[model samples]
Target: MSALEERNRRVLVIDDNVEIHRYLREILEGGAEDAEFDAMDAALFGTGAGPIAMRFDVTSVYRGEDGIEAARRAREEGAPFSLAFVDVRMPAGIDGVETLERIWGEDPEMQAVICTAHAEVSWNRILARLGAPQRFLVLKKPFDAVEVRQMACALTEKWLQEANLRQGEARTRAMLIAVPDAMLRVSTEGRCEDLRAVGAPQLELDDMLPGQAAVAAREAVASVLAGGPTEVFEVEREDLGRLYEARVARAGEGDALLLLRDVTDRRRAELAAAQRQLHEETIAAQAEMMLALSTPLLPIHEDVVVMPLVGALDSRRVEKVREVLIQGVADRGVSIAILDMTGVPSLDAELVDEIVATARAIRLLGAESVLTGLGSGVARTLVEQGADLGGIRIHRDLGAGVAYALRARGGRAARS
Candidate 1:
């Protein structure tokens, strides 16, 4: 900012003496002759420095009560006085010490200078009343103008620097709150220096994180400090059955940062999904093997083949039977195909129709279809369903069916 637009350096002067107020105004407001002041300033500071470039917005009050009110008002308006000059002997009203106490109540950070006569107020009394001597200084009556000027400059600058530092710290804390996880900064030896957790529960330094997690975190911090790459690892809470993900990275020259987030629910969901997929794949493989077992095609002679049908039949299984039987008859160039069904305990109308369709499909491929081992219930189902079992031979068992198939294939039947 330009010099004219910069913030004012505010100061408050509280004393009953009008001359004291006027003299302070002249000293702090730049009305003195510069040439004479320069020589004195050079002797005082041991260097030839010009007058302070910063300007002071000074407020003067004759009574201690009035000074307290003025300080309060200044603070409320966001332009608090950086320093206050208070006189101990205010005969008309409350003394300087009480005035300062009330004013500090309004703005505790305001730097103070207690102006008192040689023995008017004891330093012990002042220290006892104030408690923090670092915030105020004792300036005896008949103080030199140059000394007062130097004190004001140093104290006001100290106040401003401290205020800036506090603001910076506040901003840093706000940024840490924005992070949605537990965070800790640790020394190279694994001692936690700072901890912040806006999204999770707050953790203590001595207690550290928790259980095995604390040990893992310390190891991660050490690894990062030793120039190892950033590491991510999981720590499970056996008591709670919960898991956490911890990430460690170098924060600076001598410290590392560890961030932690809970991941128990996510891990559980992934494992469940994997198990479901594996179960589905296993069922599919078993179904394929069962289909093959139910429709085993065995060659009994040069031109004859026998297919044993077992288990309950659905539309899907019926289609599988058709595919295997037609493909086998055509590939083998067989003249006779025997279908044995001794293990089939029962049949429905739909299944009987599907069986007739399979036998007709075999006949279309230039093969004679023979059915054997038909249970009484299965024969009754075929009659009830009025199935067209044309151009197909029926026998009582597999041996009888194989003999018929071989005789129809122009080979003599071999008795088994």
Candidate 2:
């Protein structure tokens, strides 16, 4: 025991017998021979011990009146006794039981043990009082002085340990509640035992989690408690504003810690990855579509033919139009070629010449080229530019162009 703490303990024994004082005095200063051995291991099996057993102090008084005076003095001095021993029957103005009441009125935490020759009466009245019955002990007549010392040492030690624990718990609570992390203590069944307002400010009471989150918390609650110090998990949740991901963890001796943090940034990065995947998918689809449109060659029938002219022009589609006309005639062997101008989105003077040149190319291939589906916007543009296209036939629709081709085909067949 530290000198300061040992000197601080005061034990007031209220009894009329002077020999009782001498006896109690010897017990209070008991040596190692007075201790009970290996008999109380039940309370220390799992808890860290030995460190808690080394500090204790004891004092004893011989008279009820004297004991009461000493108790009052101790209280006035601001360091009251930690525990007391009181005999029920005593030669004084008040009895031991009444003196106990007066003593506690001064220091409520003082532990007391009742010493008496008459156990029955003392016990009966002692149990009925406002003082906790468990705090008072019964000592029969003709008890061993050494045994009294042992009990005094044990009970006083127990009371000091309890006082220390209560004070320590209060201090810890102050620290735990003020921590800056979003932390909680969760039970084995996934119920939040306590909440610390850190990362998750809304984690109050029974509302720590919602929606799919509750289910996910349940899944990992067991793994935390599978006989380990702590465990961590990453999970997802959707709140009123957005989706969030979180990292949760368990800590402490019972595997009961729970902690959460907002992981919105991580989730956003994942979303961007998914969008990139979708973009790649769309590109793949468009490529396959272009391949399908180009499969049939020109004049696989005289009735239908399509030509796609493609290339990047100078802010225009010029060579694209010329290729369409040549493909329409040579490949389909049509008497009339419908010049597909759909791919030619814009034009300049050179682009216009490319369209006129395409008509000449169709004639050279032994097929007359008819311009079809020229958007009014493009036709007006071409007319304003005054491009000469008297050589090219004009049709409003592909069907009309096809009819013209068929008519010329009939004429050629008749000549043959």
Compared with the true structure, model 2 gives a TM-score of: 0.43
What TM-score would each prediction reach against the true structure? 0.55, 0.43
Clashing pairs in 2: 298-331, 298-332, 299-332
**Span of ten consecutive residues with least summed lDDT in model 2:** 308-317
lDDT digits (tens) for residues 263-368 of candidate 1: 8888999999999999999999899888877788898886788888877778888888888999999999988889888878888888788888999999999998
lDDT, residue 398, candidate 2: 61
Residue pairs that clash (backbone atoms under 3 angstroms), model 1:
none
lDDT of 1 at 170: 78
lDDT of 1 at 349: 89
Number of the top-ranking candidate, with TM-score as the measure: 1
The candidate scoring highest on lDDT is 1
**Model 2 over residues 311-388: C-alpha lDDT tens digits?**
323423344345545665566566665665554555566666667777778788876667776666568768888878
